[model samples]
Target: MTTSSLEPSEIDLTDWDFWARPLSERREAFRALRQLPRPAFFREPEQSIMPTGPGYYALVRHADIVEASRRPQDFCSGKGAINITDMPPDLNEYFGSMINMDDPRHAKIRRIVSRAFSPRMIQRFEDQVQAVADQIIEEITAKGSGDFVADVAARLPLKIICDMMGIPESGYKTVFDNSNIILGGGDAEFLPENDEEYALKLLQAGQTLKDLVEELGRHRRENPSDDLVSALVTANIDGESLTDQELGSFFILLVVAGNETTRNAIAHGLKLFTVHPDQRELLLADFEARLPGAVEEIVRYASPVIWMRRTATRDTELNGQEFKAGDKLLLYYWSGNRDESVFTDPDKFDITRDPNPHIGFGGPGPHFCLGAHLARREIGVMFRELFRHVPGIRSTAPPDRLLSSFINGIKRLPYEL
Candidate 1:
């Protein structure tokens, strides 16, 4: 239900080339959208299509996104959380997990999973994170140079999350390979020849993940251990526990959403350090004092997961624009994090920037990232390890970014340590 508000020529969100552009160009496009008074309607292109149930409104402003996320009752997520598309309810259930849920079910699953991250567990994960960061750096530096994504960035979170899930070392590559393809959008390296092949490829990857979780869930249920899967399988909230499907779905979410994001952020952190060496020096000068803020700044700047979707439950108006029941909206965190009204010199990557108010972890809402605490620790530890050990490390070439509007990921980053 687009109105006079939309200026179609301004941009096309559905274009593949748009997503493949350099970071600067992409940010500029989003920055331009922020000036509009209302969210713009986007029509998903037909040729390179997705199963987007309804057209989506691009919510680019900080205020609008914050409002939509806060008012989850108005803008729901039960249909699906990916902007511009909606998966079938059953598929969304398995893949989207609690992220695609609303209210009772969302709360129920979150409560059970939340228990897995008790303070003691977070402390333990933090200790293990530091160890993994040191090990990754030790391994990478030993090679003198390596692809930062595989050698360094991807390893820490992959190791930590797999360790937490009790996934054996033999299966690390399986998890890693599947996740990359799942989130790769339509990148040729990951995606196949056509839509039919792509669907099969995605299904194969997804099935592999599900099989792993089911196998692990069965083992953990009988031989319960201190791992997250065991905690989840045995968890009880209000006399209800996660069903095998729910447990498997949640595990899928943790592996894909959990590992993919932090991995990209750490990769981006290294690239950012090389690009803005002064920012690196600021952190290097007083690693302890600046580390926390640096992590926030990096997340704000990188915004690993770009946008999340919300479906309108009923007719509503935001920023003076009318939205009908069932209208889909995308909360573009990347744009909101860079909104000029909120951030002073928003383009500048300032490690000392306080009152950040970034939506890197989604905005203040029920759906904020569950692994944010652990992610921050991982990013902080990795940088601490990098600066301390590989003092002269720098990216030798521009990153080969994954062709994804959804995930702000670097597929390959060449570096010299």
Candidate 2:
């Protein structure tokens, strides 16, 4: 299919209305886009906060996203990876952490911070994750039924991240609210009504998170603990440590990305199981043996992060398509996860799906998710507890989906015990 052949009215990735459609329609639209000869170009979505750029190629295929991720020198992320529009200079300090940085700088930060997220560190917290999951399940059982997102799914990641950072329980709600605002920019429930107030609100949210972490970082420097904040503040890898601003930005990235992505994955997991009972039964039959595959399938099927942006540093060709320097491309991870060429019957949620090379965390690269192991542990433990305790739990109604092109978020998912 040619660009002209597919009208914008029929399918426009940039349109907010397109994202607001039912999940099935959006999946079908992407299925059609994948069959195109080359990635289709669409005008950037208009925003009151930032000026629209020329346009961006939607990298819908798995191969294209993987290639782009591998060749970061050509399709760089330094400009911006989270947003299609260029992030303003002022916002970069808060929003532009290693995810938005190119090599050398990105490598440096990742190297220092990598120690905290290493497998050993994650394993040390394994019992903590299980404990938290048990507590959450107990609460849900006591409450009987409610919004799963709040009572169950959202609590685990939020508490885990906050505990890792040495944040007090008093600040948990603050972190949760600010992170939602940061990621839920397109949602009216979390954002202001006025268009002009959008940027200001975002800045405020970032500042709130930045201040919270900076204060903890300072305290950690004076009185260190076994928490991630303590490790980061004093981490000296070849005479390099995270600066206050860097610490703040990294915290924002960690809390928002870590909490939001894992939360959504769990939320989507319940709904997926509710819809596909056979998969749930298959999982429950032998959860210990099947859970590892189940976690991978959950991330694959319900790609929490919808897409990430990349800009061409110089002229490049990917998958036989030519592109000029400075051109923008949005790597639609959601589409890549569902590529028919990559996974057999990709739409079907099979817990025992072997060779599942899903890019839900992201395509393989320096920018791949650092907290992936921890996320898997959280989801696995949470579900293990749910299946053991609330054996008959399922979604009572369809998820109240978040209206955003970026995050496949479920604001509220009603459930019963």
Best candidate, TM-score-wise? 2
lDDT of 2 by residue, 92-199 (tens): 646969888888888999999996665666777777999999899889999999999999999999999999899999999999999999998478998875767887
For candidate 1, give the lDDT of residue 18.
80
Among these predictions, the greatest lDDT belongs to: 2
Lowest lDDT sum, 10 consecutive residues, model 2, at 1-10
User: How high is the CA lDDT of each candidate model?
Assistant: 0.86, 0.90
Task: Name the TM-score of candidate 1.
Answer: 0.96
Each prediction's RMSD over C-alphas, in Å, is: 3.2, 2.3
Clashes of each: 1, 0
Model 1 is weakest, by summed lDDT over 10 consecutive residues, at 1-10
Candidate 2 residue 265 C-alpha distance from true site, Å: 0.5
Candidate 1 contains a number of clashing pairs equal to 1
